[model samples]
Target: MAQPTTSLLCTGLSFEWPDGRPVLDGFHLAVGPGRTGLIGLNGAGKSTLLRLLAGELTPTSGAVKAAGEIGYLPQGLTLDTGLRVDEALGVRAAREALHAIESGSTDQRHFDAVGDDWDVEERARALLDRLGLHRLGLDRTTGELSGGEAVLLRLATLLLRRPDVLLLDEPTNNLDRAARERLYETVAGWGGVMVIVSHDRELLQHVDQIAELRDGQVTWYGGNFTEYERTVAAQQETAERLLRNAESDVQRQKRDLAEARMRLDRSASYGRKRSVTRNDPHIVAGKLKRQGQETAGRLQGMHTERLEEAKRKLTAAEEAVRDDAEIRIDLPRTAVPAGRTVLSLDKVRLPHGITADLELRGPERIALVGRNGAGKSTLLRTIAGELAPLRGEVVVPVPLRHLPQRLDLLDDKLTVVGNVKLFAPGAGDNAVRARLARFLFRGGRADQPAGTLSGGERFRATLAALLLADPPPQLLLLDEPTNNLDLASVRQLTQALAAYQGALIVASHDVPFLRGLGVTRWLELDGELRAVDPM
Candidate 1:
């Protein structure tokens, strides 16, 4: 394959948090002109790298060089709700200049501002239409748009900028299926150097290469996400094999060392016995003993060195093996009887003109899905009793828990165990710690402050607190739980939910994840609840 032109480069990059927690140390990366999917575990500094490349963040040491202008879309994008769509798209000044010039203003500044963007509005509108945001007129304020729409709008702004280097972090987190498809198409058609930090498998499929950030280094994998997985799997297999071989070698070395020690002891004993039997002279016997001792010492040193070398190889091999732990919890307490009524919603009218009426029984798994701004979250919040229905009754006789997208339930100041204890006040520390261990927060990990956790760790902590509550949640509500989650974290969550015996209503746009949930029913929330075929 031909090498692409280098569009972005980072050399000797280093960064640390305010608290002296090192994130990246002497990291180096060079991205060329093509779509590169940047993937890693939650706190691997993928986002931080993008920020450094975009100049949004300054590295503690090293340099970032970009061939041209850089456009960045952060993971947690929060637009100024007061700004107009045109302003957000960064074309407001150009549009105003064009309008002023057309109105017969001969201002030099207007001409200067409109220099080459006379058709800026037309281009902006066209881009908006392409992103499914045409209905959101340029005059509309950002407050009118949904979270997904805001993400797309931010993307449109970057697209309009036409930068040579583009960095997008979790662009599809809030996007629905349709919006995600649109974003996927955009990624597929991206011409310049684009580096996307995302866990969206569909979006990753459009990338030309994968740049995995792990342990403060970048490992390049040619082709897309599937190819990356295959490559990594093969690499891991080889690593495991090497590790086994290394272990075998170490054992053999140990055996050889033991045998050598035995031989040395026998030789010493035989030498002593021969000297006694022969009645050799004292000086000769002493010399013989010293010679035997020297030979034994040399043999022992050689064997020890070999053993140490084998052990070092074993360590290296072990390091090559990946250990992405998954959540494994047995929550039998969360189980509901087959005929039990878990929840009931009657003529429930939620915000954003959404209405839902449904009855959940036993441990039915329902997948709630809809387009961006379709009020899927609203319905969930209403069902979770976080929001009051406009005009209807919501009832949940059984214990319930809600894992919102923001995961705000966790208190940052508290430790993971402390947070879980708060939810399950009656549970002793031993019990809470034992349950948290199942969530992968073992030993010292459970004592880490919630605020200091990585994205995946935070999710696990939040889930632990929710699932390990006093009265086990029989009906659990999860809103886009996979958003911002790494692939391993997603798998961990899937495993946890798989073992969950309670009824689940998960509002998510991740079709693969939803499918894996063994959803018994598919519901779409578009102004009202309606049964939909499995996506």
Candidate 2:
């Protein structure tokens, strides 16, 4: 048998919101050494349970037993990072500072009094190299760094502390392929127990085990994303079968009850008519009473069947999906234009701001491939006209729509509907809600604050606003559109994009999404203008 992880254990855990409805009811899970993926739809109590496990939030009814040191890397935690590159990486200096604090502050007093002499320089250098940050220099502040850079630095600091357990939330939300793969390698090699909550299917592929949270409970399955996927599909099929059976049973019972009531009604009326005529009164009354008993029995049976069928339906429906989004319907759409030049770029040099510039044109679907600082964002900016080229002008004939990798353009304080309306006005509430529903952000979700939405949810809202706009743009410039979308939502999005007749400029490292979208054109922005056929 595999050894159970010693540090973390939760038994019969339950947590309730202010309304007293349990979000986590009798949740049971065990955390052990090696990397594990926590899979669930957003708001399925995954984050809430994580917080309770990390000691950040207390469970309302049950206990969380954590016997080891814990370090938490929250989702999109780059906002509060005031550390320089060296400090963020916690190079040798932070470790030395720990030693100094242990050695009665002599080293600290010396380092504080004489700057780098207090061993800060040596410590910083060592940690920076260990984390591949020495190349970035120690003076760089995390606040101004790119999303990937900031996240990497944050991860390095968390690892430097070498806590016994690690809890990461959406660690690869905004990372490029190279960055995401690099993180996978790090997590695979880390020595402590790790619980990673992510909607990224690719990232989950690296996990040792997958624990799915649903219906206020946790179920663990051995293996990686592949196994988890198979399990979920099997559950869905079973749930569907149960639902069908339940519905059929309910309908049969209802029909039988209706027929029985008719018979009972006729028998009583006949008895009443006989009594009025003064004919066989005793026999007729006796028959009516017996008929009533049979009718009551039939009614009781009907009620029992109805209740059982209802329970089955409820369980089946819940098991089929963690939420209502699982119910898929046929989509309706209009036609698309047929133009040769969906998007064209002539002798266009991508701005050499972070890395390089390039001249490129997208045939059908194009992938913007590169590392974190390799100029994907810069190129997108140039194409979007957010950044003016230093030399040649790029031509964009098709109406272009871009959902930047970052939600920087979004007003954080606005409601979800408000954000969508900002991009597209004059749309009716029902129309806007329909768009949100297409993106799986419907119901009361429209009233949610953009800032409070999960990374995946925010990405969906942004795309919904852009794609649902009147006269859909012929050229779609997507910078990591799959960054935070859930599995079901991603599938829906993939289908929608696949059916689109316009051109696609996708700057993403998600090979699966690109493959599913049938990307034909491939471009790499290294330092100059060039293209490649990734066949």
Candidate 3:
């Protein structure tokens, strides 16, 4: 393949954690002017690579070269809550300078500070308005903004800079459907060299190409996310075919070796019988026997060598196949009868002016849709008994469990097995381990401290703990469960939920995921809960 022009380039890059765990080693990449979607499983160094490109973290070795100034919107963006909107956008000085000049101060320092940005306030407001943050005035503090709003505000700051290269990590993590759409549009219209690390499939669809980071290497694929998936699927099919052929070859070689040994044994028996029957001379017989033995050794060695080579080829073929494990488990105890009422809300008034009055029966799967700050999470929390409704009541007749967006349900100090055991005290270690294995936490993985796991691993651990609870929850509530999850992790979550035969209410902006769950009811929470058509 022809190399792309180097708008942004990194060569011989290497980095490691303080404890000497390697992440990127001698990694190299060159990206030209266009939008590129950087994708990989959690802990595959996507965020770390962005940090390196943005100059937040220094590489242990090698260098990064960019055509011009770089702008970065990190995954975990934390602005000082006390800062004003203008200050956060990095235009406070220019705005102050413009204000001084307007008041008739002709100081050269003011002109220098203002530079050519005489209309800084206007430009900032325009950018904010474009990003759906017009409600937030320049005087407003960042603390007043919601998480999704904060993300947009950060993007606005980057857009104002007009950097030559833009790098965004998980830009739509906390965004609701509307906010995510805004981001997707921005990504699609981006004109500079942009690299975005995100699991949001819709956002990825806007990219010109997909760059997958895996096993300390980068693989490039042309076109959008859908194209990438198609290419990968075809590659996997070929790999699987080669693996099967290799396995068959190994089996054939084994059979051939066994047959060769049997033939040699038969020849030795015949030679001994013929020598006794013919009464050949002792010296001649001895010489002939030695020659036969030497020939047999050579034949045996050749078959053994062939078998070993076939086995080696099989091993190599196996390595080529992908092994993205899926969650497989039976949750018969979690099943709810069709006529049973699992949960109900009566005139429930949650924070943010959300009022919901609804009843959930049987194994109804609900997709809760709304814009950011619309109290979707509040409703879920109230149903899970984590928050008290301002007015009215929430009644959950069956056992319930909630997987919050932050996935804070697991104790950081405890191991995965310990956390599950915490929820199921009556269950033995063996039982818990067996169940955890289905969640892809087998043996030593289950013993790892919860604090030491990656984003995907942490989600799985939390989910396992909740699903394997002593009573086996029949009503499951998930608040933005797909947030921060990679594509593979999202697939694992979907697989696990497929086996859940219970009432499920998932408040997520991930329409594809909700649709995959076979959502029976679509509810929109915009001040009032009402049924809506499937999105």
Candidate 4:
């Protein structure tokens, strides 16, 4: 069978937020059948582009054209808790109509609704199971599912539509290892045009091409993210070389200009001496001096123009080199002694009846991996004392802090500094401001209300508050820390965590990120918490 031809094209696309902040300006792109990974720094309009393609958002000044139907799965999906699994899957009416017809109701409306999807219920269930939602029934309410489960459920609904163009933004944000593989498989087998905006390195590796969005434009690269990196590395090298050459030219031009001026001065001085010695006519002397001055002015103008042109070229070269800033901080007080016990859980059972028996000492880093709703977040909350375990006890011998997946620890009404002050009450205003600056919130940025900050900024503020608590935390618990973060924010977070000398327990599905953390233990939480290979 021949696969359907798919195409998504946008021309002269321009979009601005309600507040008049420009995100994309005159951007143009055409994507055909294949997997295209959309990547860029946070706030580069990757999500905006996806939204425009999906028709969820209208472009300010351009058009989006697609060869067929479009399906989009947005980031931070929140399904209606009142909706049933079948309704969420978009098959409730079809299933109901099918059942009605089977009962001998020959209503044409029923048949119309049923259309060609007689097995809609079966297909819905099959896709749900394929995404690791086997235990969830069609009649189950959305409230009964976890956040990650809801994300997968939404994706299942899209797959059931079988649209010719698919847009998935951070699809694997809350998924586990098994679920991620399932998603990877879906992408690999997809024949239609698909655009995915994700920071997941493994997911990007499955893409056929890479489209990088930067400065309100999209640049296409011929291969996957690894190839994109190699190409970017080479581009950066060339840019740096050009910048060096431009700088050298500018310096040479400056020197030559200075020498010309000196020579002009000497010529004028010698001319004056000769004129006086020969006692030449005043008119002839003046004319000669006028010609000399004009010649000198021309020479200076040429050298100056060359130097200015070189500087402009240097500026352009510098622009080509990305200047991604890194987050750097030192938490010396957060360190733990080699023999100090940071955390201990003795037969601790969470509200979901998930049990854990664990111990950590020194600066040990542990990764908590499990499927959605398998009680990973519950376990972390239990360890953080935010929830009481049903059976046993959790002992924290050192001061600790927990960064929840939703980053709800912050008070939206308060400014970033105000929130930090609530955590570190003893610290002075200047001190708190200084620390916040280290977290990339400098000066006035620390005064922004928590509710107004972007996702990445809010995460940074929340982390700053936690780390700068009165008694420095020795054990840090982070739950899906990379959820809504862009690739740059992810790297910033990774670098920030790298400087912490404390023991850490991070519950996340990001395998690449976990590997970068120097994790000493890997724990998978299903019904119990036990050590496992990184895998």
lDDT of each: 0.89, 0.70, 0.88, 0.88
Q: Per-residue CA lDDT of candidate 2, range 320-351, in tens?
A: 65444632222233233443555445555654
Question: What lDDT, from 0 to 1, does candidate 2 have?
Answer: 0.70
In model 1, the runs with Cα more than 4 Å from the true position are 1-6, 100-113, 412-422, 425-437, 442-452
Candidate 3 local lDDT, 1-535, one digit each (tens) = 1123439899999998654667799999999979999999876888889989999889999999987889999865678999999999999989888999999999999999999888889999988888889899998899877778889999999899888888998889879877887888888888888999888888899999999999999999999999999999999999899999999999999999999999999999999899999999999899989999999999999999999999998898888898877887588999899999998899999876778999999999999988887887778878888889999988999999999877888888898999999999999999999999998899778888887676777888898999899799999999888877799988878887888898899998888999899899999988999999999
Best by TM-score: 1
- Candidate 1, 1-535: lDDT as tens digits: 1125648888999998665668899888888889999999877888778888889878999899988888899876788989999999988898999999999999999999999888899999999999999798998899988889999999999898888888898899889877888898988888889999988888899999999998889999999999999999999999999999999999999999999999999989999999999999999999999999999999999999999999999999999999977789788898899899999999988876777899999999999988888888777888888888889999999999999887889999998999999999999989899888888889877888787776667888898899889788999999999988888888878987999999999999899999999999999888889999988
| lDDT for position 348 in model 2 | 59
lDDT of 2 at 426: 80
Maximum-lDDT candidate: 1
Compare candidates 2 and 3 on lDDT and give the better one: 3
Q: What are the TM-scores, per candidate, against the unseen true structure? A: 0.92, 0.79, 0.92, 0.90
Per candidate, the number of residue pairs that clash is: 0, 11, 0, 0
Off by over 4 Å in 3: 1-6, 58-67, 76-79, 107-109, 425-430
Error of 3 at 285 (Å): 1.8
C-alpha-based local distance difference test score of model 4: 0.88
**In model 2, where do residues sit more than 4 Å from their true spots?**
1-6, 9-30, 45-65, 77-83, 91-108, 111-134, 138-146, 174-178, 258-278, 281-336, 340-342, 350-363
